[model samples]
Target chain A: MPAITFIHPDGKSDRVETSDGESAMQAATRHGLDGILAECGGNAMCATCHVYVDASWLARLPAMADDEDALLDGAAAERQPASRLSCQIVITPDLDGLVLKMPERQV
Target chain B: MSVSGSPVTGGPSAIPHLDVDPFAMNFFADPYPTHEVLREAGPVVYLDKWNVYGVARYAEVHAVLNDPATFCSSRGVGLSDFKKEKPWRPPSLILEADPPAHTRTRAVLSKVLSPTVMKQVRDRFTAAAEERVDLLLEKRSFDAIADLAEAYPLSIFPDALGLKPEGREHLIPYASVVFNAFGPPNQLRQEAIERSAPHQAYVAEQCQRQNLAPGGFGACIHARVDEGEITATEAPLLVRSLLSAGLDTTVDGIGAAVYCLARFPDQWQRLRGDLSLARNAFEEAVRFESPVQTFFRTTTRDVELSGATIGEGEKVLMFLAAANRDPRRWDKPDSYDITRRTSGHVGFGSGIHMCVGQLVARLEGEVMLTALAKRVARIEITGEPKRRFNNTLRGLDSLPVTITPA
Candidate 1:
């Protein structure tokens, strides 16, 4: 299991251990975290699960798919270089200490 | 003929075309064959009847929904383009408006229906669902649609909205008209319009601030008006938007979930064993049986997609249901697999204009399905489920089922 840290926009941090292959969005949703909306149920479609990856960990994540990139552009919060749809980020053992900062709001 | 009289840009001249009216009764009754034809034809096919381009494949449909600026919904998300024709009613500020305007209004509504607010209703909704399921189990058998699906939402939603209880029956008919009017002015649309007139009036009357209960969503929108987020007049229309778009689609969704579980007993067993699969089961059900089948988006300008150039203002019908089951997207797209990852399905329209009320719908589904899973050992379809035909919705009028207790 990979432990993921979700830091809300308000600066509170909640860390949870997620199963391998479950999405970061799924981990947050399963634990009933408030910040990750997962509105389309972890679909890259809604972009509601927008999160800003910690700069150090960004290089280890998978490349943003074109559809995810496009949806990120329309997300409610400002799009930073580290921004990603959490749904697209599948949990894996190597990324055990992954950190994600929640957006101000996910519409 | 392009509505804007713009010449079609570079693309295949002799594009594959379909003559069948997608919204016609026969097609609505059983659209799978037509969906296959449209998908097999090409990425983009011309519809001769409506003179619009149709995309049934998952890739193209997904592209169109993501590129809202190119495939604009502000003109109206229906066959009748609002620019060229008058809308039957005031257009939805959230659904029919573009960015900037859409961004602001969506922000307001999003805040109103945020997860924080949604949490407020979950326990109450769950309790209500348990009560409904307990009463139904005593009967042993009932029409799942009328007795459970429709009954559950009608019992909870209107009261949650703080609506006066008397004429709540109007909600479904009014919603039918609202969704049907999204299609061409065909017999289905007309019939729904006629049947929904009084309900429509009632809905309009109830949207006023004076009519809403103090703590309801309607009243919340009215409070936003006082905070200067939106105008006083925009408040009621926003309330009207929720009323029109909310209930019926959910009823259809709940009905679809029950239909899918009853058809796939193994899936029901999975749900009964975990009970936590309630939400995922609902998502799978939406993907397997999309309640809202198709919606049209007009081209904002000459855009080339799938080797076809659609002119500005030309309507492009996106078959969301077809896209959900496109073989290109899923390994067994047509199968109702509860374990499948149904994340990308367009059962709820994608992008900015996606259903704002979806969280509410998901909650209702979770509560109802979990309640059934807890007590019902098996769901057996006792009679042929009758299809309810609408221009856009896919649902059952009646699904006769007998439940064996756990």
Candidate 2:
């Protein structure tokens, strides 16, 4: 099992143990963490699950897909360079200490 | 003005044109064949009867929905362009508006129907669903559409809005008219409008602040007026948006779920084994039988999509139901498999103007399905389910089912 840390905009952090193969969005949803809307239920269509990857761990993750890139442009929060849809990120053991920052809103 | 250039590269006359009137009675009765014809014809087929362009493929439909700026919803999501034609009613403050206006109204709704507020109503809805299912189980056999589907949502949602209970029956007819009006002014639309007049009047009266009970969604919208978030006049229309869009879609969704479960008993048994699959089951049902089938989006500019260039202001019908079943998108697209990850299906639509009431609809489906899974062992259809025809909605007029208790 790998541990994932979700950091909110207000400096609070919740760390949870996540399994490989499930999405980061699923992990947050399963743990009932705040700030991850995932309104489309990990569909990669709704940009509600927008999260900014910690710069230290950004290079370790996969590249954003074209559909995701388009959706991020419509995100309610400002799209930072590290902004990604949490639903598109699959967990792996190698990414054990992945950190994600939740956007303020996901309209 | 005759449009020039053909997507096929032969000539302007080479564009795939069909004589299908999408809103016609025969077409509405069984749309899948027509849907396949449209999808196979080309990416953008000209519907000569209605003089509109239509797209039925998954990729193109998804693209048009996502690119709201290029393929706009502001002119109207229906066949009638608001700018050039008179809308059957005033345009929806949320659905029929684009950014800046859409942005502001959507923000208010997102906050009002936020997950926190939805969670608050969950337990009450779950309890009511259980009670309703228990009563139906006593009968052992009943019309799932009228008894379980319609009865269940009508039991919980209206009260949640704090609407007066006396004339809640009118809600379905009102919703029917609203959805049908999305099509051309055909016989179906005309009849639905005439039938829904009293219900529409009742709904209008209820949108007023004095008519809405305090601490409900309707009152909450009115409170936004006091906060200067929206004007006093705009508050009621926002409330009207909720009343119009809320109930019937969920009812049809629940009906579709019950229809699927009965038809696929193995899937029902799978659900019986694990009640948590209820949410996925409902979503799969939505994908399997899309309730709201089609909506038209007007091109803001001359936009090229999937090799077809649509001229500015031309109405492009996005066949959401067809898109859900497109072979390009799903493997075994016609099958009803509850375990399938129906994530990207355009059942509730996509992008900015997606169903604002979907979270609430999901909660209703989850609670009701979970309740049925707990008490029912086998669900079997007893008689042929009668189909209900509407220009945009696909649903049953009646579904007779007999459920064996677990």
Candidate 3:
């Protein structure tokens, strides 16, 4: 199991563990955490699951898929260099202690 | 995603052969009991009535929608295989096509229907919603389906679509005919089609470039043609796609929301307490009602599920409404709770062919719910709500309700 940390815009940190292959968005939603609406499920179709990954783990992640990148452009909050759709980031052993910050609103 | 692996071998140990006629009027009236039976029956049950395979469980329905390569839509998202039968009308370039074709058409639509476009129209949508809610709150009691659900969408959505004001009344019936056409050829489908002749012609006329107003979605699609991405011929088809796929569903969805709130007053109180819950409230309504009930996905190759296998070229009827309420995936699945996270529900269908115009639907729903929340305290049912029967959709014909102002 990989535990993920979600840092809200207010700087409060919450953590949850998810099984391998589940998404960060799913983990947040499963635990009933706030800030990821994920209106389109995990299809990378809606950017409501927007998150900013810690800079350290940037190199560890796979290149963003085109659809995710396209949708991130329409995120309710401003997109940043570390921006990613939490739903597109599947949980794996390598990403075990993943740290993410949520946008203020998901729309 | 085409099947190139070893041939699918064994079938399920036991497959329940169902005797239910899914398209029957009674089934549409109260599908919950039958839906539960289907989900519990098997992952893939054999429907002897249509000689088709039925997938009602969440896992199977969701998986099938996502894996379009295996459960292809190009063969027609209906009972009749396009490969063998002649379509009464042209198959939708966006709805009924596979990748490459679906890819191109969807791209243009995606950009046109994105939340970015909604940004430009947010105030307009909100203003219209507020104006209507003001009138309705004054009425105290009225048919929510006709006054709010149908009327609101009829007012705003057509302006967004760039449709002419004269024949806007035809939009709903035209969409009804389009959705009804997806069911097995029956008396309902025949009558809907027969009664929709003027609607059909009105929709056809509206699809043309000259008939559309500039700066709206229809002209915006034609703008793609000007950029040389799609041909002039394909432009009207795409505009037609927006008109066909867009109108009726929102009315169904909004009606579903109001209907749910009226029946589930506790949930309405929550929304009244917090207007921010508008979008999720509407989303939950859609999941609770499951208006766009079912669509048939034809298998491109042999597909196996939990304990069943469907052969290639066979029609797999996806009971999306059943999947929405499947106990395996949802907690207290039958209940309507506004706060519940309904992200994974197949309300808009899923995958590349998911409802491209969903953002607009959400916007329309969110604003209306918000307006109601701010002013209305209680939605009391005044009379027996009537069901608007259709082969594919589950929605209301009339919801006579009295609103107590907040």
Candidate 4:
């Protein structure tokens, strides 16, 4: 299992191993990461699972879908180019050291 | 205004092209026609200028609700242009996220609200609902929404959550405004804002840790805070979600159930003959007249729905009411028959994001309706009922009924 680290918006961080085929949101949730709220169960509809992917890893991820882009626009935290809805970002073996940051709020 | 350029494009047939404002409709005292037009206008019709899609059909609405991935809720479940205007508050901890995150939060809540845990409080809840219904039946003529529906949930929910009822009057107004904001910024939002202004501070105060009781849901959230699951500050917001989402929805649901049974004497008689129908009656009422009319979900990509290309980032509104009465899915969709086996209805939503507190709502409905079915032999309208104006909720402001006690 690959390791994933989530740095809370408040600068707090927790690292957990990602199960094969689990998305970043799932790993955070299984480990009980403080700030990630995937309210819609990984459907890109609710922006509650908003996260800022490390800029270095941005190019490696797939392009944001139209729906993900629209919902990201509604995230409670300021939207950044690195901001991606965690539900849309599926975890694959190619990306190893994934570091994501939580948003100030999910609503 | 032509339907193409007007706000009421999918409005009732009588005024198809005109802008139909609910508040204005409230004055006329009936919006059933408007509901019909919206239902007839295809599954995803443009609500004129408001870039949101209106889903009035039964099948599609339930499909969208169940598939959170297709109709995502993360962009704040409300109608606010979440991209531009900041929400009055944060997204709901449980209702507004997709799975994995939604799964985690829901797990915590599901554990808390499990049937087993609810059983602990079931007797108390049943007793409270029964007592309120008993008291109301004694009066013979009462506003069903206010006296029974509103009274029962308001009294019991706050107690279960462990909050003091010193200034709980604001619960309905606050929740009404909160749910209204989910729709377009129309007259309904303006009114809710005005009505909620006075009670903002008290509501905020209730969210604080000091105000919560030790053994209730609110305090349970506080305990989660101590365990570092959620911040202490975020605890109140979680409590706020339960309080806001839980109250009026159930109240309206039960009220609608009673109203339907009263309107259809045969169903009422069937219920009277078989007291066991109380449970089915609640679900039947939800199917006949859904408490939640519509909710919006943003598509994750340029998804294809019913052969229509839902552009990425576009908002698609699911009309649960229309879906409940979808002619294709339900036989005699409009009729309120308690005996109908309505298993797959979207009244409590579908999928992982379905209502977490549904059991609580069901219990509330069952207790009240059972008491009424047992005590009343006949019920009829005493006067014209007043419908409450809300963007997302469908309920009466006042339901006047004359109960002929058995």
Please report, in order, the local distance difference test score of every candidate based on alpha carbons.
Answer: 0.86, 0.86, 0.88, 0.74
Native contacts recovered, in order, as a fraction for each? 0.11, 0.08, 0.42, 0.00
Tell me the tens digit of each residue's lDDT in model 4 across B1-406. Answer: 2234233434243222323333244522555666567666555566545656666777678678777887788876777646667876677777777877776566656555654556578789878877876787779888888888788888889888888878888778778877887867777777777677666677778888889898888788778766767777667777777778888798889889888887889999999899867877888898778888777888878876665556777777677776778888788887888766555577777767777777677777777777888888998889998877778888888889988879
**Chain A vs native chain A, TM-score per candidate:** 0.97, 0.97, 0.96, 0.94
Error of 3 at B191 (Å): 1.4
**Worst lDDT 10-window in candidate 2 chain B:** B1-10
Quote the positional error of residue B23 for candidate 3 in Å: 0.9
Compared with the true structure, what per-residue lDDT tens digits does model 2 show for residues B1-406? 1222224458654468777887877777778888888888887788887899888999999989889999888899988899898777878889999998987787677656655577678899999999999999899999999999999999988888878877887888898899988988888888887787798898888889998888888888888888888888888889988888899899899999999999999999999999878988998999999999999999999988877778899999999999999999888998999877676788989888888778788889989999999999999999989999888999999999999999
Q: Could you tell which candidate, 1 or 4, scores higher by DockQ?
A: 1
DockQ of 1: 0.13
lDDT, residue A14, model 2: 96
Per-residue lDDT over B1-406 for candidate 1, one digit per residue giving the tens place of the 0 to 100 score: 1112122445555467667688887787778888888888888888888898999999999899889899988899988899999888889888888888887787677666655566688889999999999999899999999999999998889988889977887889899899989988888888877777698789999999999999888888889988998999888888888898889999999999999999999999999989867887998899999999998999999999977878898999999999998999878888998767666678997777788887788889988999999999999999999998888899999999999998
**Stretches > 4 Å off in candidate 4:** A1-107, B1-36
Structure candidate 2, residue pairs in collision: none
Model 1 chain B: lowest-lDDT 10 consecutive positions: B1-10
- Between candidates 1 and 4, name the one with more favorable lDDT: 1
Residue B90 of model 2: what lDDT?
A: 79
Q: Could you give the candidate ranking by DockQ, starting with the highest?
A: 3, 1, 2, 4
How much is B299 displaced in model 4, in angstroms? 1.9
Over the stretch A1-107, how does candidate 3's per-residue lDDT look in tens digits?
88989998999999899976899999999888878888988766668999999999987988898777888888899989999999989989999898999999999
Best by TM-score: 3
